[model samples]
Target: MIREEVKIISKEYLNKDVLKIRFEKPKEFQYKPGQFINIKFEQEGSFRMRAYSILNTPSEETLDICLKIIPNGLASESFKEAKENDKYTIIGPFGYFQLNENEKEHVFISTGTGVVPFINIIKEFVKKDYKMTLIAGYKKQENIICHEELKKIEQENKNFVYKPTITREEWGGLKGRVQKHLPENLSKKMFYICGLKEFVIETKESLLEKGVNEKYIKVERYN
Candidate 1:
């Protein structure tokens, strides 16, 4: 896909190595909440592309992406150096991870940068007053991104619930993977999960064991 120049509007740190960057896209840009965009940057001798989920509401003029920096990672390194007003090529709002608008109850399960897409979807759900639950798993409380924002959502909407889990830290929130928090009864709700390969697989198994219909579950896996 050909890339279009998108102007950076703002950037902020979410955690130790994660960044939330907002950019300005064309007014006509329209994409589903869980869709992703392909970003390209030149390093060494070539331009490499990486996929990142869109982290803002579709109705908004600004586009956002939650990026996690990894050692020797091309896209994250280049993005870390990007400043406001800088422009770069963005290829798409792709992928099929999206909410079923007709479904009244929904569960969003995520870990690390996998939480980005859920953030976008939850924002829309809040605007529309949809019933939802967010289960985020991290290594520690400090590793949970968007902590304050999610807490506010939970407070403002009685239908919304946020649960943060830590696998390696002793914290006040739920300790363990999101799989530990799946409702005892899952016959009536929809489920969405995004995360590392193993995490996704394990969560899927747990949900199946709890009686969540296979067709009602959606997942996006990242290595």
Candidate 2:
């Protein structure tokens, strides 16, 4: 991959742990919603690269990557200390998790930082006026990143529905794994799910159990 220099335009904590880092790339840098970019970082003996989803929409000039700061991982640790105006090498907007225009209703299910891709997708929906339903789950209430943003989107677009589920907390909304809320009537919609391996597998199973066609389900697994 040809590495390109992208400048860090801003950095903010979406949650206490999840960080959203916006970067400015060349004007022509373009990619689909669910695709990701390979981030290049320094290493002593070998090169270190990590794939992060492009969390910015076409309407936005600057590119962005929503990163979760791991306790001791090299990439996460480096990003934790990365300052504004710093430039880093980013290669490609890879992967095939992007949704198509023909797919009218999107059922996006994600856990933890896996919700990053859907954030971009929902942004596009708002810009182009499409319909989408988001179901995201986390371990606890405070751990839920992008809580306020999701609520705002839900309020802004009538077609946009946000359902936040928690595994360990009692909440007014759905209070279990996201699978518990998978719509029974899914014959006409497309599904995109992103999470860890187990979470993705279980979510796929739940969708299948509810009669969602296998072809309509797309998954992106992280670690």
Candidate 3:
């Protein structure tokens, strides 16, 4: 793997624990919308690495990544303490979670930070005429990240739809797990899902039982 050093351009706390960070894209770096990069930093005389999906489109000059800080996690602590212009080593353009490029209806389902890759995919690949739906699930209202951006995309493209759901809090919008909100007919739609392992397994099983072909569904799971 080729390692490149990138400078942090900016970092902002989106919510209580989630952070949105931007880095200077290396001149030689080339990646697909849904690919991820591994960031390495030194902590206690040792190197710690964590993989995060890129959230910016290829047309953008910078690389963006969103991560939820885990208490006591070396990588999370390092990110939390990062300041602008801080340099770190990055390796990759990894993962196969990308748009299929076929002209077909698409449904994207995600929870928490799992929505990172979809942001780039929609902005970079989904054309205005492409049919797409995003169903995102969060635990509470304050935890809903990137709703404004998603809404902007929805307003700009008539073919795209955004639906956000809350499971642990009362919400005026959709309420319940994303798996329960799956469209009735999956005949012509391709499904892309990302979330916790249990959620992924349950959703995939539900899709399989509903007669959706395995090849038509792509999934990525986080711990």
Which of the numbered candidates is closest to the native, going by highest lDDT?
3
lDDT of 3 by residue, 146-173 (tens): 8899999889888888889999989789
| Candidate 1 per-residue lDDT over residues 78-160, each given as its tens digit | 88888999888888868899998888889999999899999889988776857899999998777888889999988988999
Error of model 3, residue 32, in angstroms: 0.9
| Candidate 1 structure lDDT | 0.86
lDDT of 2 by residue, 1-223 (tens): 3469888989999878889999987777778888899999875566789999888786788888888888998889889989999878999878999876787788999999898899988887665656788899899898887789889988978998899899997877789989887776888899999989999999898888888899899999998
Worst 10 residues of 1 by lDDT: 1-10
The best-first sequence of candidates by TM-score reads 3, 1, 2
Q: Which residue segments of model 1 deviate by more than 4 Å?
A: none
Measured by C-alpha RMSD in angstroms, how accurate is candidate 1?
1.7
Q: Which residue pairs in candidate 1 collide?
A: none
How many residue-pair clashes does candidate 1 contain?
0
User: With candidate 3 superimposed using the best TM-score fit, by how many Å does residue 11's alpha carbon deviate from the native?
Assistant: 0.4
